[model samples]
Target: MSTESIRPLIGISCGDLNGIGLELIIKTVSNNKLLELCTPIIFASNKAINFYRKSIPDSNFNFQQIKDFTRINPKQVNVFNCWEEEVAITPGQLTPEGGKYAILSLTAAVEALKAGQIQGLVTAPIHKKNTQGDSFPFTGHTPYLKEAFAAKEVVMMMVASNMRVALLTEHVPVQEIGPHITKAAIVSKLKLIEASLKQDFGIDRPKIAVLGLNPHAGDEGLIGAEEENIIKPAIKEYKQQNNAIVQGPFSADAFFARGYHERFDAVLAMYHDQGLIPFKSLSHGEGVNFTAGLSAIRTSPDHGTAFDIAGKNKGDESSFISAIFTCIDIIRQRTAYRENRANPMKKLTNRLLANAVDEKIEE
Candidate 1:
C-alpha cells in the first residue's frame, strides 16, 4: 500500500499452447485476487486461450481479447493477439505454428516491457527445440533475456521457497563449466545477483554463500585447484562490498544439507549440477525460476511442461502458483524501491542504514 509501489499490469506469455503453459495459466488466472493485485494481459491470441479453454477440461475462463497494447479494464481479461489463426495444438505435438506463437508471445512480452506499458512479465515454459525449430541459437529464457537486455553479466537463480540457488553457469554441458571459470565473470555475476536480491526481492542486505567448483572444496588443493584458486579469491573480493558478505567454497553436499542454508540470503553454486541438484531436490514442485539482470521483472515456474501429463488434470500447481506469487512480489518490490529512492526522506533513511550497519558490527 506504500506510494513506492503501484499495481503493475503483468504481460503473461503462453509458452506453447499444447504444453502445460495453458493449463497453469488456466488454473492460476481463476483466482480473482490476481486480477485485483495487477492487471493480467495475455500477450497471446484470443484463439489460443479459447482453444485451450475448449481442449482442456476444468478450464473456466473467458478472456476479453484485444488487438493492441492498451490500458484495459481490471475485471475483463485482455489479450494482445499475436496469432489470430488456430495454432495446430495436439497435446504434445510440436508444430511451426506452435513455434510461431511461442516466439510471438515472447516478442509481445518484450515489446510491452520495452515500451514501459507493463511493469513486469511472467513467462510460461517454452521448449527450446520445439520453439526454435532449427534456429534455437540461445539456451532458454534466462540466456535469451540476457541477450535482449544487453546484459554484461547474467545468472539463473531458481527460488521456490526459502531455498534459493544462483547458478554460476546454466544450460551448458558439464564439461564446459571448468574452462569458463574466471574471476571477472564470478565477480560480475555475483554483483548482479546481490543487487537483484535487494532491489527485486526486498532483501535489504543480502548475504550470499558461494559454492566451490570442486568436491570437498578442493580439500586443501587435493580435489581440484579451482576452488582454492578461483572461487576463494572471488569470494574474498566480493566480501568487501557493503552489506554483501560472500561466504563460500563450501562442499555442495554439506551446504544445503543442514538448516544453515537459511542463514544466508542466497547461495552461489559453481556449476549447474552443484546448484540445481540441491535446489530441485529441496524445492521440487513448488519453486519459481527468476531471470536476473533483465530490464524488467520476469519470472517463471521452475518445472517444465509435463508432456506426458499435459491434460490429465494431474499436474501440480505448486511451481506455477509460486511463479505468480513471485512475479507479484518482485514487481511490488521494484516499484517500492524506485518510489522510496525517489523520496528525499526515504533516500536519506536508506543512506543512514547503509552507513550504520558497520557501526553495529563495531559495537
Candidate 2:
C-alpha cells in the first residue's frame, strides 16, 4: 500500500443477530464487485454470521475473521469477533444472546472509528427492545451512535439517492416539539446541515431549504408562531454566519411539491414526523440515516430492526446499501478535504467551542 494512496478501512457493525443485519452483511460482502473498492471489516461474531446464512442458503459470501483492524487486506471480508455471548445464535430468535452480541459488535465498531482505524462506519439495525432487556439503554440506532461518539451537537439526517432530509428534533412526541423548538436548536441544526454538506458531501456552497413548522408557514402567525417567530429568525441568523445558499421555511406539503428538490441540497425538517413522514414514505426501505455533528462520520439504515421478519430472507437490503454508499460518499469528501488545501474549517473557533461548552453546562 502506498503512503500517498490511503485506502479507507470501512467498519460495519452488525446490529440484531435475529434480523436482516446478517443477511445484508452476507449479500454486501459477497458481491465481489463492491468488495474491491476498499477494505471491509465486520465487528460481529463469526458464529452468528454463519448461523444466519442458512436462510439465504446459497449465499456466496466468505466470512473471514481477523484479529486486528490494521491487518485487514482489501480483498477479503475481514471480521473481528466481539460477541462473547455463549448462548446459541439462532435465526429468527430474540434471545438475550442476540442482545448481548449486538452491543458487543457496536462497541467494537465505535472504538475502530474513534481510533481512526476505519474511515467510515455502516451499522445495521438493532432491536431496541431486545437490547434493553439486557439492561442496555438502547433507544434506537441513531441516538445510540450519537451518544457513542458523544458529540456536543448532533442531528439525524436521512438520505436517499439525491434527496436529503434532516430532522431538527427526533424521537420526541408532537406535543413536546412545541417547547423544545428553541432558536438555538434551529440555528444549530442549520449550521450542522450546511457544514456537513460542505465537509462530507463536497459541496462548496450548499443550498438548504428550511421547512416550516405549521401549515402554509403558520399563515403569518395566525395559526402558529413557530414559523414566524422561530423558523424565520433561525434561518436569518444562519444566513448571517454562513455564505451558503440557505433559504425557505417552506410548508411541508409545498416543499415536496413544485420540483424544488432540483434547486436545493437538503431540507431541514422542523420535527421528527414532519420531516420523516415524507422522507420515509418515498424513501423507506431505501434510505440511509446519517448522524451529523459528531467528531467522526456515522451512518445507518433509515429503518429499524424488523423483529417480526427476522431471518425471513424477506428483508430488503436497499437501505443497507444506501448506508454503505453514504459512508463512501462521506469518506471521499473527507479524504479530498484533507488532501486539498482549500478547506473551510482550516481555523478553529474558540468562541463557538466556548458556546458549546456553556450550552452543555446550562443544559
Number of the predicted model whose lDDT against the real structure is largest: 2
Report the C-alpha lDDT of model 1 over 284-352, residue by residue, as the tens digit: 578888988887788898877667777555667678767876787777567557868687467655445
In candidate 2, what are the lDDT values of residues 263-301, reduced to their tens digit?
788998888888787888777468888988887887888
Instruction: Give residue 261's error in model 1 in angstroms.
Output: 1.8
lDDT of 1 at 39: 71
Candidate 2 lDDT score relative to the true structure: 0.76
Off by over 4 Å in 1: 1-5, 133-136, 241-243, 344-363
After TM-score superposition, the amount by which residue 47's alpha carbon in candidate 1 deviates from its true location, in angstroms, is 2.0
Q: State the C-alpha lDDT per candidate.
A: 0.75, 0.76
Q: TM-scores, in order shown? A: 0.89, 0.87
How far residue 58's Cα lies from its native spot in candidate 2, in Å, is 2.4
**Number of clashes recorded per candidate:** 1, 0
- Give residue 83's error in model 1 in angstroms: 1.2
Clashes by residue pair, model 1: 160-287
- lDDT (Cα, 0-100) at 24 in candidate 2: 82
